[model samples]
Target: MQLMEVCVIAKCTYKSETIMFSVSSESSMVDILKTLCLRFRGLQLGCFTLRYSVPSYPSCFLETDSDLDLMRTFLLISNEKTVDILVKDLCGISEYSGDFCVNKELIACEKGESSCSSTVEDRNEFLGRSKRASAKPLLSNEWETYIHHVGQKFDGGAEEFRLKLCKYALEVGFNFLYAGNDKKRVVAVCSNKKLEGCSWRVYASRCEATGSFVIRTLNNVHTCAGRIRESKSKMMRSRVVSSLIVDRIRAKPELKPVEIIHEFKDYYGIDISYYHAWFGKELAKLDVHGDESKSFNELVWYTDAVKETNTGSLCTLDCEAGINRFRRFFVSFGGCIAGFQYCIPLLFIDATFLKSKYKGQLLCASGKNGNQGFYPLAFGVVDSETEENWTWFLQHLASILLPMGRVVTFFSDRNQGLLNAMGFVFPGWPHSYCYYHLKQNLISKYPKSGYGKLLQDRVINLFSRCAYAVTEEEFKVAMEELVIVGSSKVKAFISDLSRDHYANAFFKGMRYGEMANSLAESFNNWVGVFRDLPVLPLIEGIRQKLMVLNSQRRFEAEKWTTVLCPEMETRLCENAEAGRTWAVRRSNSTVFEVFADYSVMVDLEQRTCSCRLWQIDGFPCTHAVAAILAKRDSVYDYVECYYKTDFFRKAYESPIFPIPDIGKGLGSNGSAAVVCFRQLQRGQPEDHQQRGSKFLFVVVKVDGILNVGVDIGQAFNTRRF
Candidate 1:
């Protein structure tokens, strides 16, 4: 066996010493232990273990022969020249024994002269180093791990020190207050100082040399009971709470006050009031997204920024008479306006309530893309859902869509204000009423107690059948059934409504199979989370959502390989399958006779069938499908151009640019001084007056443009109330 030089290091609570030894490669654990005991002289009296001094493998204990062999193999593989072993005390009793102390010096002298080749000078050099220097405490960045001591240094001045002290006192479950506070110094003491004479105190002063605060005196011994100190702590204020929950609020802005209270109680073992949590959350929100009141003022800059970045876009702001008070605001992105040319011409108009500090109404005009997806055309915020407001919104919409020369249809519930507005703005256009809303009105008009709900359901079903009927004869049959079962009032109500608005057979414009304004409802639900924000943020949020929707749809449309959209293709395929059993007879190149349950005439040239489904739905119906298949023609050719993949791509090709941050280069030095309108006082209770006043200080820097008599129409096209 080959011999190797091994260095054995012994460590205890008081001292550490090293000695050299000559060992054979075949040495076992027992052999090494016996040699260590004989050489150290103190190991014979107490429990100890031998471990390899490999820093990477600190717990490699050599307790058996296999452990010794593993250590040797590891050392050989690691190419270590010297074999280092650590002798650790297992019982920690022998290092302090008088006998061990007397034998340590004798063993050192013997080893100094032995053939192991370790000298007394080398031993003294290792033992002369201070133990405190080797075990110095490390500084921690976490406040929970910080320990206060005299002469400790902090980077910031009195404010930073006070903040850290508050956090530290809270972490340790103790109450503290400032005994002396100023810009140059801060002195904190236990809150129980007057009652119990608690000695816990920390005094920090600004250092003249480094301009940082340094702890001049610290007496960390507290004499008060733990319960009293923890229960009476006043360190948990709104400022501290804001600092603690700022990051959480930034990640989830919808976090409620009750959730914050529960989080503090469960996580920090502290109880807080609802007001503190709410105020803290408000402060954090201000830090994250700015003040809600100021966000209203940012609207002017935001509108200008949107117009500058997105060319051909229209943004108008309306103010009350004689004062710069906000009344209504409207925005229509250029991309959405340009893209509407490729979407379905039918617009679903609706209004939803805003849930902000200053409550308002959100009027939306949404369309359907080629794939039957919701496409928002334009939206605006108004003071209320009145006829005048609706008329103003429709005027802006007309300015965008009327120039396109396309025959558009308006679909919505029969809200009186909306109906009146539609009549005033687009008098010649076709407006369809949602049959669902009409049925709801009927249900409300006739209570279930008069005749059970079953009768109501039957009446609504018969009316729905009439609305869905394909021809005048079918509608007449459905109406006869309804009249036989319905009361005289119900019959009168149904007769008063125009059949051209609800009945599919009499509708003058193509409805595209839509019977309700579900698209606007969907848009409302999509932006529901952001409704609580102020006016500017709500508008910006909608813009961001539309931007993402357009980009995502454009990317998805790029990957489509079908000639028509997937929805239209599926509809065409289903119609072809249904018509498989039907027989077709050719009349001419453009005319054919399809025989099924009832014979229908198909005109391929007009893209219509006698059943009326093909022309109304913008696709080949069952009869038309049979006739087209008989002629060996493709069904996709008869589908409307709006349902083509090329049209879908065009609908989402325009990009919606991001609006830059407000107040970038803009200042509030202009002559225009805008304020929030106090319109809620008209019909609201006294308690709502404060919420109405939240919209404040909407100052716009008109510069010299408005003063120089620029046409108000050319500048803003705004309607003054």
Candidate 2:
């Protein structure tokens, strides 16, 4: 409620529109603008800044927390009251139409100036004289009635109510009485009177954010603080700058201290120390996310809400009542069913650090879809990436994965935790170590000198080539090259790791050809900023991204011209071109011999070539291409089902149902019978689903769910839901 400096404006105008308000000359432009933004959805608040144009000086933004009177002096334009809100950072703000600007004309008027609006010379004098306000001294019951009415009109967030209270005190000649719990409550008393124990107090009653707030008027002074003072210190405490910083962090919790310091300084011209900025950031979080420890307490409710609303979503939280009360948490959308079935069966596992107040590790299990991009299947939050933690993660993963077999493969870095965990959960299942991590580990272990630098580069290059080699012969040649110059330690490292796990040549036909954990690594980096937030916020952020990704990928799939995805199509074309030089002899309609440096028998019936490229990789190998050319086979039929656009569409067909805000009650389609099935393509609850007549139900994609409705051909079928 404190105005530090005073301004007396001559005139006001906005060249664009005629906007009217309950005028108060004493009110700061910031307060007016904020009130306007709240009322008008058309106002792009954060994008634009208030600016004042003057005759002698060029037009500039109003950067300080200054009052209207002080700002008017700098205005050289005829209409000193008018301020332009110059908008910047225009991206995605408008989707359906072009960029639009609203022009507002603020006319300067002297007739309605509040008595509190004072000039520099008489500012303190006016405020000092009018510091206290008079209220019709009322009984306790009447005061309570008045408080209730005030709360009804301005009932919202505590901060918003705080602003309203400041305005009310200024209007009614009262001041903050000050009382118990200064952190949460604002108590206002008669400013006209001296600080006393029996002053009538108007208390802001903050309730659970979803509900309305009530202002309570108390007669008794069970708890009271000294009367409020009008000074720089008082102004600093109740100023909009702190609240603005808090709002910024609430919008983007990932903002760091440096960013906070810079933002505060740049906008307000007030230099805050790193610690002050940090304190502001923390305070902001407290307002936005509530208590850090309490967020953990809400995990159970949050997960239940998620599962109840999202249906097939997997949200599991495990806690142990030991020294470390919090243990592990894992969550995944039911859309994973589609991803696992229609996308490549390769899962990339990786762990990233959580930079929130409670430090931990984020373990992710992601798959590569037709577009060769990260298709996040599941995520786990653990105390650390230990064998036991990973085992817990993998064990839970096994639950949602459904009828797991050796057909599904996993890629991970050579972490002992993953090795041990995968060995237990997947036992005989094929596990591939990331080639990139292996090379990085090898390089780190064998630090080389000036001349050895070249050797180091060569060793890394050889290892990479070995992993990517087209055939066993090519891999063998690279191994021989490494042996001639490789160190004993490097050689031992290479020998210890299974070739089938890292080397493309050693891997048999059941291969997805994913030699690295790039899917998970890239996904981790994609959500790098979100990971810097609290557990719930991070998960919420990822969920939002997944929703967008599901829609976007499906949209992109709709535009594809070929049967296979763009990348697969491009790869097959390249192989087909290369196969032109190779000579092929037809043994039968479905069999052919491709003669190159070595003879590769291509069996069209089995869709496998002797070179194994056609089998390991979903795309047609050069040998397969040669046979297809000789046998006149359909190029479309050779590519794996996972590479097709239809499969890609199916991979992202189901929506990840949105979970409602924590206190907004259940979602629109939330139910109690509970969802034990995958998410539907539309937003409708299972209980609400109406059974239809004898419709053919065929499953083009096998997600282990027997959805027995919808017309289709040549796939698994069912009769009813």
Mind giving the per-residue lDDT tens digits that candidate 2 earns over 1-721?
Answer: 9744433332222211224444244666556556655644444433333444343332455544453444554442354444433222112222211122222222011111344444564545323322321312121111111222222433455566665554333322235545543435666654433644445566666655644445555332212344332222222232333466676776677888788767654544345566666766777777776544445545667789878977777788786543223457899887765456787888888888787665678899888788787788899887566678899999888886655442678888888867999999877777888888898887886657786777888888888888888788999999888877786967788777888787888764355666677777789878887876767777877888888888898888899888888988898888888878889998988989998788889999988888776667766888888788888878888778888888998998887877777745423222111111122222234343333112322222123222443433323244423
In order, what lDDT does every prediction score?
A: 0.73, 0.62
C-alpha RMSD by candidate, in order:
14.1, 18.1
| Collision count for each candidate, in order | 0, 21
Worst 10 residues of 2 by lDDT: 670-679
Task: Name model 2 segments beyond 4 Å from true.
Answer: 1-242, 321-324, 404-406, 595-601, 665-721
> What's the distance in Å from true for residue 211, model 1?
11
Which candidate number maximizes lDDT?
A: 1
Q: Estimate each model's TM-score.
A: 0.69, 0.62
